[model samples]
Target: MGVIEDLADALARDVLEAQAELGDDRFYEKMSKVLGELSPTTQEAFMTSVRVRLAEKRGRDFLARMLAAKRSGGAAPQAPRGPDSGH
Candidate 1:
């Protein structure tokens, strides 16, 4: 990855860790604001990294749930629905 991507990825990891500890779901937004003060390019990269990491985490969680359900001979778990999902 390029310098911007590398920096953004590292910052995204830190933000995730902080959010986990503080239980503040809006931490990413706050970080975005701070990055915006630095530069629009940096802020955009950070936001993209943050979003990708978040989506990955959600997929991991869903996979774990599905695995657990399968082990217990239960029904397969449903994928999480986003606001854009009509279901």
Candidate 2:
């Protein structure tokens, strides 16, 4: 990821962590206050960066799933049956 995307990711993680620490009751207010403090351009850039990162992550996940399915001969994997699973 480029510098902008990297920074955006870090910022996002920080915001989420803060929200978790503050709990659901204050999450929205804290997020709104932080977002409100940002310049419009910065906010736009941050959003764009975050979107790009998400796309990349999803793309990677898709590729991994595809590879796993291919390795299993293009069939969906079956879960192992246990003694209690009724086979």
Candidate 3:
């Protein structure tokens, strides 16, 4: 994916995090407010931008960069996993 798609994924993660912080009702209201701030033209442009980004090669490149950084003395943070992962 390209920058736009990466941004969207990051946004989705953020939304999920926010939902966890604020309940479903508040989350909806917050989303509505944030999205409402943008014009319809902006929304359409944003979606197209993300769609183009999603069509690119980004995830693998990003993962490789992160792993390389980790091997080159970067800290390896432990990630949280779901219960189905045999933890």
On lDDT, the candidate that comes out on top is 1
lDDT of 1 by residue, 21-48 (tens): 8989879999999989979899999999
List candidate 1 segments past 4 Å from native: 81-87
Candidate 1: residue 32 lDDT (0-100): 97
User: Please, what are the lDDT tens digits per residue for candidate 3 over residues 6-76?
Assistant: 65456544654566567672453455346548644434444444444443435556677779878899875
Report per-prediction Cα RMSD to one decimal.
2.0, 10.9, 10.0
Question: TM-score order of candidates, best first?
Answer: 1, 2, 3
| TM-score for each candidate, following the candidate numbering | 0.86, 0.51, 0.34
Cα error, residue 6 of model 2, in Å, equals 7.3
Q: Model 1 — which ten-residue stretch has the worst lDDT?
A: 76-85
State the local distance difference test value for candidate 2.
0.61
Output the better candidate (2/3) by TM-score.
2
Q: What alpha-carbon RMSD in Å does predicted model 3 have with respect to the real structure?
A: 10.0
CA shift of 25, model 2, Å: 16
Q: How far is candidate 2 from the true structure (C-alpha RMSD, Å)?
A: 10.9
